[model samples]
Target: MNLVLTVLEITAPVFLLAAVGFTWVKLGFEYRVEFVTRLAMTLSVPCLIFVALMRTDIEPSALTTLTLAAITAYGVLTVLCFALVKLAKLDIRTFLAPLIMGNTGNLGLPVALFAFGDQGLGYAVVVFAIMGIYSFTFGIWIVSGGGSPTKAIKEPLVGATLLGALFLWQGWETPTFLTNAIELIGQMAIPMMLITLGVAVARLSPANLGRAVWLSVLRVGLCVAAATVVGLWFALPSVALAVLIVQVSTPVAVTSYLIAEKYGADSQDVAGLVVVSTLLSIVTIPLTLAFLV
Candidate 1:
């Protein structure tokens, strides 16, 4: 009963907001979803990440462990996808990004917060910060054939992460006013991202759903299973293990859609994967956590 309530408490708002966004679309709220997603990705989400990281104390010891875990988890996922892609003879340029990009920011971050509160949030943020840098740099190199590497390097959120770190490095306190403002904007990231997600979902057609569903299932199941076995062997903390597991288990990120759209991959396929995996994740994530607990 408690677990059921906990799942609902954590996830209900997400589904409800998605429904609201869908309804607003049906009701002719033109571009509602697009507007929200653009704002969230460009501003609110970065602010949230910056504030979270800045507010937390940097523990070098724990940082090493988290970094190792992230590298291991991501590295394993990449390898697994590569093997699968090759074995299945899938098109690498179009399908690889979607298959490999885990839902670190949206689903993973929230689950981390719920499972482990502030600590989990911080750890998850750091893992994703590292992942984002890699995704933009190495991911772009792989996807875009090395042109405009600078474009990949210059994400607003990267700037925000650096600013937050600079504050920490310089030992400067965040002014009360600035901190408060950042907090307010940061809080908007999660809900807005979800709504943007809904907009993305609303756009997907049934024709693409078949392939997307297969990819999503394969991505989630294989990646999470691999992470679970490794995490168990590492003797990571329960919360940390849970965090890593959930992060790896999440569907291909919505960013996969954007990247696919840019690089001429099947954007429809990517979006469908994102939407299906995210919805399916509500069940898979909590169950994975329950098992870990």
Candidate 2:
């Protein structure tokens, strides 16, 4: 019972803010998704990542282990998803990216922050960084049917992650005034993302949800299993392991749909996967957290 309440407390604000966006969209309010996304990614998210990494209490070595663990887990997920898509005879371009990459940023970061406080956010940021780089580079390649991976370098969060990691390693801190300013911007990340997520979902026109349902279930199982194996193999502490599982098992990202649309893949199919998987998460996330918390 205590665990149930703890899980609820951690999850409530996240979905609630998202609900606000969803309802706002339904009521015909104008929320510019592309603009909000640009603002968050270009400014707020970078600050959040830098601040989290700089303020983290986790040792650099533990972070290194988590970093390696996240990479391996993603590698395993890539292989597994590829095989699943091939066996199912689905278009790899449309399905693989969404399956391999979860909503680690908008969904995963907030969940980690609420569940495990700053330490968890710190760990979550590491995984988010890894995912961001991988998704931008290789994920774009897969979605676009071959492309230069250099675009990942253009993302502001990439620089922030590197700079923040450097700060952690060298025991550096920004001046108090700058830190406060950066943190104030960073504070916008979670709510902005959650609301944007809701807005995006409300606007999406999904397709073939019956197929998406089974694929989404398979995705959740495979992702959590891969993370669990990698986390245990690395002997991650409880919080790290829980964060890994939760992040990996997050729903399909809205970015996946946009990438598919931009690259002329089957965006409708990807949209279905995103919507079905996200709604399913309302159940799967709490159950997983109940056990983990």
Clash-forming residue pairs, model 2: none
lDDT value for model 2: 0.95
TM-score of each: 0.88, 0.99
Residue 259: error of model 1 in Å? 1.9
Q: Give the per-residue lDDT of model 1 (tens digit) for 1-293.
A: 88777776766775677676666666768765557766876788788877877776755456557668777877887888888888878777766766767777866777677677777777777667766776786666567776454664587777777776666556676889998998899898876666666666676652377776777778888888777777776767777777778777777777777777787766766677777887777678767766754
Model 2 C-alpha lDDT per residue in residues 151-267, reported as the tens digit of each score = 888889989999999999999999999999999999999999999999999999999999999999999999999999999999999999999999999999999999999999999
CA lDDT of every candidate: 0.72, 0.95
lDDT (Cα, 0-100) at 171 in candidate 2: 96
Candidate 1: stretches off by over 4 Å: 32-35, 165-172, 206-208, 230-235
lDDT of 1 at 256: 71
Error of 1 at 47 (Å): 1.8
